[model samples]
Target: MRLRSLTLACSLTALTLGPVAHAAPHSGHRDATTAASAADKKPRPDDTIIAVVNSIPLTTRDVENRGKLFALSTGLPVSGELMDRLRPQIIRQLIDERLRTQEILSRHINTPPEQIAAAIAGIERRNGMPQNALRDRLAQDGVSLTTLIDQIRVQIGWVQVLRQELGARGRVSAKEIAQREDALKRQDGRTEYNLSEIFVKVEDPRHSEDELSFTNTIIQELRKGAPFPIVAAQFSQSQTALDGGSMGWVQEDELDPAVISMVKQMPVGAGAISNPIKVPGGFVIITVNGKRVIGHQPGHVITIRQAFLPFDAPLNPEHVTPQQQQTLQKAVKIAQTVNSCEAVAAINQQNGEKRPSDPGELQLERMNPQMRSLLEGLPLNKVSRPLVSTDGIDLIMVCSKKEKNFADRSPSEIADQLMNERVEQTARQLDSDLHRKAMIDMRIKLKGV
Candidate 1:
């Protein structure tokens, strides 16, 4: 009887190991006994022949193909450990999805097919890819269009379910909105801080038991005085992680509400650490180092400039044919010869038929990196290098620079910013709470991926 029970349990378990699955049984957690008896045989992922979700069979083809898809998309080295971490998160996610799908069906909520198609199209466009390009990208990550479609269906269906399950009739009182508005008005000229932080990225929403436990352990270590920079280097998912995740002191309003609330409650010299901040993939552990005030001065006469490259985008050196290289050279030539910011603007417009005037405000404190570095040690009226901005080759002329004075920030202004921050923090906590509680048969493990 136990043998048959174990076999049946294993079959059901595979469903939870949807894409890349992992399972290790340990004592003292809910479902621990069940996990031990069923998972003791420890079937290798490939050996797990079939997955049954609510008695519905899911073929190995689905899981393997999905795994291949995930691997191709990320382009990261897929070590044994990576696979082990990927499995449980993927499986649980799929299980939740299956459950969500059933609820949607039971509610009889309909997601217009056209709406789903439009949404998918918008996603592709935002990624700057053609329809076929999206498919190619997915294929590169080992994903099939079919897989994407299925995922989208599940998501759209969920939206329908949410609309039906949670009615949107709830309203924020006028007094609440007025209070929030006052909170907003208070932020003007208020001191923003300059600080550095290490943010450990949480990428997987449905974490494997091992991965969850591992991250929790890391978070614990971080809470216990681990150096922010060192810990970030080891675990943060941000590109800035290489530099200890130093994006510099973020504006209070710019931080994740949870992070900001935690910081607000602490003193200046004090650093606050969070229990993993969840993301679509995993968790982010943030440790703040410091903060400063930020603002733009009206006397801060700023000149913003950039060279345009029109539709004549650069050549892909990797696969550039001679003709493509020639076209790119012309664009580069036009960009290199522009002598001054004004000249660049004129030339940018000279090709009236070539590229439109792409201009933006020049905020000294918000200038791009290269310009910020170049102007840092130099005095006023400095002509910066052709800094690469989002538009094109750029240079800046700081008309003036002045110290931020208290006259710019009135008490009401200060109070408003502080209050909005307070409200935002509350809203964020509520959001996290709702998400955490929404899971079914959810297992949270607090030890190694």
Candidate 2:
């Protein structure tokens, strides 16, 4: 009996079946680690050329196939817009695969031929099919079984690499665990919200009967055909009214008691607009749009950015006005004006300080509550304003956001995840730093295509 690799076959990806039609014109991958399309490769016609990254090329066929899998896994519709947004993620995955495989080859990390054959045979047995059944499916799907095996091998190799490289970086103090336990018990957990808010400030809930009717009419329109965001933008008196009422995700306990009670009754995929609820300055036509309970899995969420700051590379410290250095309020303004990481780099360059090759990732929760507050409120993809940190002026950019659900630990899984997380950060930082140091040339050579 061919036992299937549950990790590979039962992934959320299996849901997205069928390939997408390849679009013409390939886009180039900008990263140095991008893979080249092997297209002239196997014979296929539905495929079109996409962009190239470095020497590597991505074909339309590859995107369609991978996109279908990614879409199915995420349960999101495969819209062109979403596809474009996912391009960076796909490219990152491709780069990771390429880097991993390249490392495998260099490190002589080869899987035994018997292991491969056995795995395939096991999968065939699980499905109660002949060995040729897989070959036949591959033939029909235009995907190779070998290709899947290679991907799995790369994933295994990456894990091996992490185990070796990040083994030493894993350690948690008793103090940290105690603090985590305390936070779990007393951090006010998060407030949950079952909110369908018109978002106007309320001076009174029962204004003119006309006001109530007008708001109810808007709610009805939303229930029928009008988009909530569109209406919220047109009528919401809140500061973010122009943003179309995208409150993003809200936890349940965060809502008013009445609002929370109403939302608890609403179903996940459906919601209803309640009669205008009384509030301060204005009446809220509570639309129980969606509700989620407040609480997060126990584990610290850290937002880290890393680049090794090189003390020997260069140095140019800012000539701060004595006036600016002494004052807290003045420094806050200076922090807000700093834009991207590139800006910070430029500032470092100007200060003549050698910036580290990889930035450091800071644990967000360790910061002052006020600092944590700012970071939490911002979108994940955005950078934070520099805060007057005890450690000097601290600026932050998020790398990957991970929440460890504290409850499901078998000891091994916890150690593995903790080790893996550190290893991932270490790998990124070390690779970036070492790649720069290993590079032979300082200048780019331009060539005509």
Candidate 3:
């Protein structure tokens, strides 16, 4: 699979699976690693079974591992009390995963080792962790890397199941694309929001209280500087978890009635997490990235080629290092000699490409005033003087600049959106059907979890 597809799939897969728990001690609670070790030292003949799905047993050890994983992923303190509170949701998630895994095997879906490796790699890349660092992190926490790999296998296979179920409906025709485009065009002055969300599902009405408690804990972590995307990937029930809970741009009418007023009132740039808003299935936590008038906002889309030279140390205005001086001189020479974007790219390659030569299409209006002012007057193909920063100096060449409506959606994007919607619907339906047919036996009380 392509890296982007795998990255998206990796996030989608961990929606219900918690990372492996760390054994580290936290103040004011019984140590998780110690507790696990104590249990291991017990005279029990075999690991106690907690649940059974399709005649396959899930053990107390499994529950502990999942609970610990949840704690590790959320930065929550690991304690027996916390595990007790998390038990119900953890078991429910495990049950759903078991059902999905069973379905995957029945369908004979194959997720090769390479694909799983790629997914793991993608996870590290997104979280800014280095190669093999995930495995190392899990190991240090006293958990096996297999804990994550198994979850990814199920998620990748489940995606295939949904695609297979979708059949021809997965393909969106030109007519449908045209219809969506027309609808959006008609919405021209109406406001639309760019939102990200985390959906905590309440599977049974009787257990709503437990789910709400879980949701609140998640919100607390989010507000305390935990990464939203990572949290959503691990906990959200919505399919948008695949895209880090991104809902993309949606009009007010598209949101739940309860969410509309809240989103409308939210100030942009607050990065404020919403309270648990009751929705059709469960509670939804949302954050607004931005809001704009539909099809009305217009701005220039600019593409530039840049050559960046790095300094061995951070630049100091009062005490410049020799390396910094040499880097500036190199930047000046490249800027003076470079006549085209290709030439700039070549220079960047020669400098070991410390930075990307092409920074993709940038919205000119979104840039800071200083950068915007410099670019507005910059002529095409002429390299600008060095743009100094603490780490490096950049020589820029604007390759293309043009005005366009930012709100417009391309046909391919529309098609993907429609497909994702259909897949999400199919997933919920299939999950419900699996639960309806499966015989799951809970042995939680007997296992004392």
Candidate 4:
């Protein structure tokens, strides 16, 4: 069975890949007098050095590309004003990323090309795009594919660095697992929250105000319906940014005291975005996706294998092409003849495995009524009728079904959770050390930014 792990989150991190490169005057320029005189002499955004991390020069072009990336992720209409607004934060993030990148290279951490390809493929799959569609999308928007490749490379390498730093602590002990399990048992009937977060760090105490302003700006955009996961992937300082800021089910004691009170007061499923709340290292923006009573929900968990045939283009039922007709005919033959999940899996493999054959254990109660009803009566090992959609057809087979406590965590789950907590802690400490030791030079400064 494919279970959720840190790898999945790392793959999803590539979802932040975005569009275009732009040049605009922003909050400040380091050599203000020179910039002003140059602009007066010849007005345009030049490819001049904007900053330096160690000896590496960060140019106006570099910052502009990242600004455009942030714009694309928010799905907002790109404008000169928006680029200007995002400049300060984007510069700071890039500087920090440069520090991490340098550290990764110093340690000789190599991110295999296939790993990056897999992550990019994962991005397309999760975004509902066809294979290799990301490159096309980037091209259409004039955004360089290298922008995405570079960011994902660093993300993957940094994960490896964090794991190495964890040393033996990376492996959670049985005693620790038992203790967590006991704690869960003790908290039965208490409230558990399903939450997501975006953390914006303040690098220097003197720039706390600047960071807070940036946080407020992000909150404003999020409240207007910018996808939180995409924004988090682009900007959050927390390691959970790789998972689109998902915190899963967390309890009262697991959260910071400042955050606990705000989350407790927020209504679940209301899609409420919290105002910036101060924490130890940074400010946090939170949203409550749901809340559930611990140990109270019991439901059917099912495993299924599916075969998917993809359409060359979105299907037009009234104007079916010859290729589409043949695809449907092939699907019909498979549905009629395939008797086992293994057969369906084989069929999927021959079709290039456009989608995974096994989608893992699904919680039946969480599904919509139409889907839950369909699966509840589907006989085990039976090939389902072709489920046609605009872009693909699916044939599913239910392999197993069982009723269990949804709140309970398996030993492996507990272990992964502990490992994640440790990894996040290590990542933060290492990042701070990198910042403290790194030499950074700001070439531009903003007047009122």
Candidate whose lDDT is highest: 4
Candidate 4 per-residue C-alpha lDDT over 340-413 given as tens digits, one digit per residue, 9 for 90 to 100:
98999998887767778898999897787888998999999988888898877888899999998878788987
Candidate 4 clashing pairs, residues 3+ apart or interchain = 27-446, 28-445, 28-446, 29-444, 29-445, 30-443, 30-444, 30-445
- Tens digits of lDDT, candidate 1, 1-449: 00000011111112211133222211121222243235523644543534444544444345545544444332233444344434443444454455666666767877677865665555443333346555665565555667656655765565444334334322234465566456545765554554444433233445345444545655554455444554443244343433454554346767667666766655554556655555434545555554444443332324444344332333444665555455446556654454455665665555431322333444455555756666555444444444432323433434344444322444444443443334334433433443454533323231221
lDDT of each: 0.44, 0.44, 0.72, 0.75
For model 3, what is the C-alpha lDDT against the true structure?
0.72
lDDT of 4: 0.75
Candidate 3, residues 1-449, lDDT tens digits: the string is 11113234444333223443324221111112233345434533436876898898887666667666656665556776566555555666678889999998898899999999998776664443447877887777655677677777877888887777888786888899899889888888999998899887766665566567667766776777656776676567787776678877888988899998788777765679898898988889999987889877788988999887767776889999989988888888877877999999988777667566787999887787899998888999999989998767889999888999878888877777777777778878998899899998865332211
Q: How displaced is residue 2 in candidate 1, in Å?
A: 52
Clashes of each: 32, 60, 2, 8
Report lDDT (Cα) of residue 445, candidate 1.
Answer: 32
- Alpha carbon lDDT at 71, candidate 4: 61
Task: List the candidate numbers ranked by TM-score, top first.
Answer: 4, 3, 1, 2
Q: Please provide, for model 2 over 379-403, each residue's C-alpha lDDT reduced to its tens digit, 9 standing for 90 to 100.
A: 5434456454221344445545666
Where model 1 places Cα greater than 4 Å from the true spot, the runs are 1-74, 112-130, 166-174, 183-212, 216-284, 287-320, 329-368, 371-449
Deviation from native of the Cα of residue 267 in model 3, angstroms: 1.6
Q: Which ten residues in a row have the lowest lDDT in candidate 1?
A: 1-10
